[model samples]
Target chain A: MFGKGRFVGIISSIIAVVVAILVGMVFALISGGNIIDTFKAIYMGSFGTQMGLASTINNAVPLIFTGLAVALPFRAGLFNIGGAGQMYMGAIGAVLIGLYVNLPSVIEIPLAVALGALFGMMWGILPGYLKAKFGVHEVINTIMMNYISIYFVRYLVSNGPLNGVMGTARTVVIHKSAFFPILWNYPIKPVSISIVVAVILCAFYYWLLESTKIGFEIKAVGYNPKAAEYSGISVNKNIITAMALGGIAAGLAGACFTLGEMHFVSNDFPVEMAFTGIAVSLLGRNNPYGVIPAAFLFAALQASNLQLQLFAHVPKDVVNIIQGVVIMFVALDRLITYLLTRRKGGAKGIGNT
Target chain B: MEILNTTLLNQTIVAATPLILASLGGLYSERTGVVNIGLEGMMLAGAFFAVWGDYITGSPWVGVLFAVGIGMGLGLIHAVLTVTFKSDHIISGTAINIFSLGLTGYLLLVLFHTHGSTREPVTQLPYINFTALERIPVVGKFINEVFFNHTPIAYIALGLVILTWFLIYKTPLGLHMRAVGEYPEAADNMGINVNRIKYFGVIMSGALAGMAGAQLSIGVLTQFVQGMSSGRGFIALAAMIFGKWKPFGAMWASLLFGFGTALASNLQGTNVAIPNQFFLMVPFILTMVVLAGIVGKSIPPAADGKPYEKENK
Candidate 1:
């Protein structure tokens, strides 16, 4: 089923998976759990039934947004570390529009999503502008912005217009009209409108990269900025546009969480979700196509962690250890290159993806 | 007014010492063209190791040594991953942070059986008496209380700044270090070992930053807790940038930020209308503004995060 090119990618991916499993096993043993039972627990938790499948999809939905958010700027050769900040802003925008507005779902939902996207775009564009205009490394600036967004959101929840009457650091529940209703008979099933929306966005993202002139420019700029500039592609403009678009995608992820799941903005919207997205994008080699599978893999691990804890007595951070191992193995591309060199005639690049 | 002058000034220098040490650590790596975002993790490792060493050995000086050794080890890991293996700097740094959290958290569970570990008051870093230095009244009080009364580590940090200033400007190795950051290709062409210098510089940063962490857990708090470094590493990064990659400039910036922290801490008891959280936000906000100002003009080395390959086009 797999040729040499496909074989290499598959074999490498399999190796990554095996290494990850082993890392998980080591942690499970240390935490006083039998390896086989832990493995079974994780399997059951992730894919035991229809409900498990649905939960996996639910987890993958937000990851898709965050993955695309990171992968877009990465394709343009910029690292968007501020996706966490953008996601928070997106949540804020979605919550405001979802709650305060009294339009029909047909109008209200799209408006809320758009507002979230716009909020994300604005957040990303500031650093993009600074990077293009002033030549600041986006990494440092984006990190600072993450704290700003976190604290700013904290300020809004506590003291600004969104503060609850009880004085706790959270906003009022969003209106039911704005909520993304369940799309399946089973309450735990994986059929939210968010998944449908995510699939549509994924199709759009693939099209944006494969079929568009702007996409070509972004790839060109990423490959070599000087060459792109020489070719009159406006390298700086493309960098800015790609980052802004990337930020919008992250924001949309936040909107999905707000509209689909929680239906409210709280201070405890998992900080690690954004970081997990980083892991997903990296594990997927920052490919938009790869994110779907990568996200599912992580979502499965997360879902399974619940059962693993109950049956195997493994700590939930076992998932983090697995993630760490996967990243470490994937990062050893030099080793992968050496391994593949003998198989090929030295003509094929081993780890370009 | 007199009380205000002494207390505020004293707190500023006291707070500034650790920041200055950490920022100096940042300067060493950054000057050699490595973006060391793992500093926070390294500082945490140092903090934990220091306390662990202190508890075992019953000597804070030994704890300081333990921190330096551990910091160097962590720095070596970063060096191998980013410098030798060509991993992404940010990803490697993120892994370090996550691993530190897990490792420290796990250690806490196993070793201490408490989430937070505290030492008996006996093994604390003994504060110094500066009677000879304190003879000059108001100014003397500020200097003695703020600068002199700190543990041995504070004086070491001040001496390090002067030594670093001399090393960077007055030595051949220093010239090579700057060359490696500014133009690695040029340095490579001139037969300088860029990789070795970068490794030395980064490990040096880790050792110094480890001392900063040691100062925090042993000298001030007398305890080790999870997430103890907080955002000090990032703040030190800000100091490095705000200081325009100069040692003295970083020192001054760290001192200023330290003063801001001291003032904010002092105002908590006062009946002020502003929330204490807003005051907490002051140092970070100032860093943003200062960073933006220096964004274009402050030149990072040409090959800052790009991994060095000896034989590439």
Candidate 2:
């Protein structure tokens, strides 16, 4: 597993991340911020206290789900930019079910989750079907779908039947039984059991991609769809399945956000999570196991953002810049490794002549 | 009957200007086989710089130049990654989008000491009022309402569309770009510098997209709001595809989207029974339907998104 190429990949990723952070620090300095204070604020805000740790884990839950959403489609050579839309649809579904359904905790919770996943699956499959049948590019279709879903949900909460009585563009609070229970309450606003679900899903994703036949086909398709088609794999089926699975993950993220953390769906719910998932998935190299750590790192950064803004005088938007730079560096991973290898007297470069 | 009012037509023209500019920019790069998903980011950078330049220099034209320069800089970065380093085009473009989003927002806070938007308006781009043309016969009313009495950039955008059409179909340079896009190996065999053409195409896209951003900031709004480009970049991409990658086709498609936007805004004020959100979704839905090939098949260039490689001598 630790071959020369894998080792090089790991090293280059580390270098990329470190370089990005340093670049962010330089920007902070230019913006009249003290680098040491900013770093400290970020560190303390994420993991320094029990409250900070809980917030970090809470923030990480949705990221892991969205990361898997991007990763699964990536495994099948699909971009799946519809995670935001899928998540929004999933949230709407969950909110509707959570608001109306009256059942025992055991039944209602699972039902809402399933509905969320199903709604997201439907949204995901539309683009997949379009791509499979009409050769429509998923990137454009997914983006369009995102705007449609966002606006649709906005309409649902703002003016539709589910609109709250408080004059806010939100749904009513979910039933208590439907809420995700606090797995561990260390005095920090009750850490939800959703994190445990996220972990299990991550494990299941790893198993699916590693052991299952469908997973093998998805990976094969991702590697080379033409080759996979020649080898008897149904590339189209894999594309649909991969996207549907990704949608399921994103849908679950929405469900967790509504049922576990926020307990309500609002029009202004953070849609940036879907975009951040792209950064996390790329940083994790799209590996399910790798996403856990990557999600944690990003979650920590996010958890610290407010503190960074308050104490270090750095705007939260700087984190976006850092994430962007990290992604750019990740895209140039091969070049970085090539330079490193060339300096080490290995004449052969990685990828493209 | 008022739905077809001159005000709506004027609004449509205003909305279409940026889409035409950005789509045409996308057309140039895509013609040379480079998929530019970063047009949105380039536009955002342009919007930010346009406002910033106007704020500092007190000249909207200078701000437009600043936006174009910054846009070219971003395009150079994209070209280096996609053309020279042979990075994945989509990933590089996505990075550009994300980078610009973060960089612009961060700068907004640092420079303006505000978040979400720069509330202060910069000098607006000057509108060209043709008084003589407005006094002409019946045609003058149509011309004055639809085309005249607008910022000079709008006229430039319309002219650029025609220029782009002529350049791509009539000129030797256009033929070489098409050759590079359609068959890089063939172009390479004929001694055409594939990388140079790709670079020029992408850089030119950046410049055009930058000007589009300037049009948005100075011509339309006169202030830079975070994510002010909104989905216009993506819409422009759709317009490019809907137009079948032709300059005139993209202009028509852009005009259609602009009409959709204008209609949506118009409906929001009237007693339209449907939710305004649905109106906001019309352009995106239309884009998806177009991409689904329901209207017609919109195929991209054969070599589009593929990196060119030179053979060893």
Candidate 3:
């Protein structure tokens, strides 16, 4: 049986998602599109065939990592909005190693991935250090870092030594030895082994958070820094550790994207995947286990959005509207709970409501 | 030499107009203790609506009004979520930003049948030439060149800087708003309507940000591009913080950033070895340095980012 508190959270999340979809449907109707066809397009785009499903899962791969990146820091009462920047740094680090290091597949792939994680960890730790040492707010710092990382990467690829020889604002194609092998032989898109890595990482994240003393310290600090300090925990240390862990996940996401799909780094590469992770973490309630399904849902929507646009003549921007509304509703979870409880003649002593 | 200085000064003022307006907007919200991170989204909404209004009505002034109205509507949503529901300000802000981007993009496709940007040119806001001033000597030349020949919003932005300083420091309503930000319970005890003051502060921010957006679309570019606000709203937030949440201080900070932007564009024209992107990074890097308190301790409001509840009292 589900705990009453968890049951309420799950029910509210479900309602929020359904409400968002309905809102999207209304938008479709106004645009003179058939609502049923739009819905059908979304379903067909995400799950109509094995290839569609594979692509949907492939899209989820980055979301899962970015979700973990956000969720881990949230557990320590920190918002890691710099995931985009950290992911970029990770990608650049991986690309540098992938293009330069001419080694065996086993050594090169793991090294590139580790370097990516290390770079991401560096980005995450800077803000954490600033917050711990100077009382600087991480939100502003992380946002600032995001722009810095973006511009820096652009400069490197566009005009610096990393520029490709082919007159494009991108690095040279990464070595084939660094490529992640195909896990499944799907006709349309080969499912990269990065999906397996992501699942393993998710399992590790769950184990680390649920069964470790550091995890307890992180949650305790997140709950109340003052109380955690009184209990002899180093709040600063936990903050740094949690941020580094989050960065590591984000960095791995960058590596996965580079080695598994992109195969090279370019200036025009999309960084919005990191932003979608915010929605994912929110929908997941910042829980490691919850992030999987949350990421999957978001990924499916993203994968299907194009099909909806092409087949149903619905604007793909509707997906953005749905995602935005879902986050808004989730943020207003207290209001939803109040309305629901009031309608039910009051539920007594529901936690955090 | 005089021509270069005049051009630089002109560019600086033109660039600073939006920043000053947006920062002043941020100042009001922060002064009333609401962290308005959604200024970016609100400004984007304003920019889009300004173009839409201009495109439909064929008048820039009407477009500016539309932008302000839409911006305030977004502000109202933020007020309800944060003030009424007692939601986290940051979460509400992030949601508002995400919502604005999506909603604006959706509206653009529906109304204009365009992607990425509106193709139609909006009616540009008129400028004051001050031709009489140009006929005078050195002083008049300075005045004509530096203080005139820009959109009316630039003048309005300058005037608002002084007005904001006076209002926040001298007015009774401003006192109540500041008191609410510092300590809502204390303001409540003093018979101030805390919620009303906060709402007004946030809504005023939205209006100003909307104007800033209008300045960008109709006043500067005469067309609305997707994500046209760029990171100016965020830069304004940094200016607000760099100014230590003071109106005059924020204006000066805005000017500094405006100067940085002007310098960046100017340098890009020169044979500088550094890439254009590095110059673009200057504002963001400076923001980080300022936030790190190397410039000074840029402390925020006392009760900032906290949701007030009557039961807690």
Candidate 4:
């Protein structure tokens, strides 16, 4: 991975990020913001202070899981846009157990998280199974699954069974035993151990995909399902496993967010993060290790949402605009690469541009 | 106590109008080989711009025109990315969605002082009331209520479905589009300009989807709500699949899903022992079953969603 190719990737990534920032600046200027002050405010909000930095790390924890959810599936050439649905299922499973069960924290927390992963795994298997059996496309199937899971969650929360004491849209707070252990940081919001879990899972993912036989078969199927099948690898099995693993990661994201931060599941579960995970996966090149920094970049940008509103007078939505622009350019990076190589007179890559 | 009534059917037609238009949009693009999941985003942009256009010109028709322009512009971006750059169709569609989501919100804040809902102009599109037919016997009132009382876009949706059917099955241009979607190399060998047809299909899809947005904003609700298209775009795609990608089949499927939506909202608080969300899930669940080939095989065009490139040799 350490070569001229890696250097080129780093350079292009910088270029993409820079262009995205410029686009954001343009939006700020359009919204009647002073350029330098907005830049300073964004800096001050995201990385300038210890408190802000802690908040950024906390924000990144969920993104790390969601990003891995998307990245994990891309390893098997599957597009898992169902992260939002998977996350909701995770939250539901965790909240259901956390709200109903009584146990020691050591037992309850992990149990709830595991249930969340199981729920997400069930959701993931639907699309994977459909795609493998009927040759139906996963993209549309995953999207349908998202709506189904989302509406089911809505039913459970709003007056179906899980409504809180006040009978509002949210559930009652989970038992304290279900809470993730909080890691004390530099004041403000305490960062949860979820970040450690996210990092550990990423490492585990690296080993699972790179050093394991099952991982090799999964990747081989993604590279070419026909070839993998001819070589005695079960393409269908790998596809379903890849999707289920993604579901587990997304479930962890939702469970962690609920247990460590929000403490209850609600309608406003940051569904957009699922789409942002796509951008992260692209930036990370679908590599688990790369997801860490990519998630941080997005989370830090989102951290400046309030500062952008207060100082720049730009709406908080502008950060999403910036991220959207970033994803667009990143998606177009292949075109940029093609142009770069054409300048140096190189051959086209494996896939035609 | 009765759930099935003319009022419900009337509501079904009204709700299905947007789905019909958007699914027809999906039909055109997919028939020409481009999978346009960005219909959701495109519709949102159209909804916002329709309100903005009405605010600017004080005319709902002009608002619709604005929506068409925005939708086509977004469609052009999708075409360039998927067709020329050979980017992943799904990825490019996702980018377009994200881009439109932000752009509409950004512009809404810039144009209107608030977030979420826009300032709706009082003037909306007129409904074509067929009160003259009420002078007839028993069926007259039923016909007027269910068939003729909707805004003009409803009729346009119907007209375009027929038009799309004729164009796709009858016209030479549509033949070229179908060939490009099914076998681009073969089409190219037969001297058809494959990319040109695909661009037209995609742009037309955007135009129709934009009109769908106009229907939502100016016709149905009389204002633009943030993310108002919701998952209708994706639902429209499912409807298209249920209809076997034919314009007429898609139209009927839209009406069925639209009926589901209408029933879901109407029965939200009723003691029917079933949650409204379950009704809402029916269309999606049915599409999944159909895709699984339980009832019938729902096959797409051969080259659908794959980028086409002319030989450089």
Best by DockQ: 2
Candidate 2 chain A least-lDDT 10 residues: A344-353
Predicted candidate 2 versus true structure: per-residue lDDT over A179-243, tens digit per residue: 98887786745788889989999999999999999899999988888899999999899989999
Candidate 3: TM of chain A? 0.94
Q: Is candidate 1 or candidate 3 better by lDDT?
A: 3
lDDT of 4 by residue, B1-313 (tens): 7778788899899989999999999989999999999999899899988999998889999999999999999888888877776677777777778878888888889998778987645468999998989889999999998898799999999999999999999999989999999999999999998888989999998998999999999998878788898888888887888888899999988998888877776676567888888977876786677667732476789999877777542
Q: What proportion of true contacts does candidate 2 retain?
A: 0.70
What TM-score number comes out for model 3?
A: 0.96
lDDT by residue (tens digit), candidate 4, A161-249? 99785557789999999998888755568898999989998999989999999789878877888899998999899989999989999
lDDT of 3 by residue, A94-174 (tens): 999899998999999999999999999999999998888877777778888888999999988988889986567899899
Q: How accurate is candidate 4 locally (lDDT)?
A: 0.84
As for candidate 2, its clashing pairs are none
- Tens digits of per-residue lDDT, candidate 3, B71-157, equal 899889989888877777777777888888888888989999999999978789998798898778878888888889899999888
Error of 3 at A195 (Å): 1.5
Using DockQ as the yardstick, the better of models 3 and 4 is: 4
Best by the lDDT measure: 2
- Please, what is the whole-model Cα lDDT of each candidate in the order they appear? 0.78, 0.88, 0.86, 0.84
User: What TM-score against the true fold does each predicted structure earn?
Assistant: 0.89, 0.96, 0.96, 0.96
Candidate 2 wrongly placed segments (more than 4 Å): A1-4, A186-188, A340-353, B294-296, B311-313
Better of 2 and 4 by lDDT: 2
What would the DockQ be for model 3?
Answer: 0.52
Q: For candidate 1, write residues A235-312 as lDDT tens digits.
A: 789979988988888888889889988788887776566767776776676667777788899889888867877888
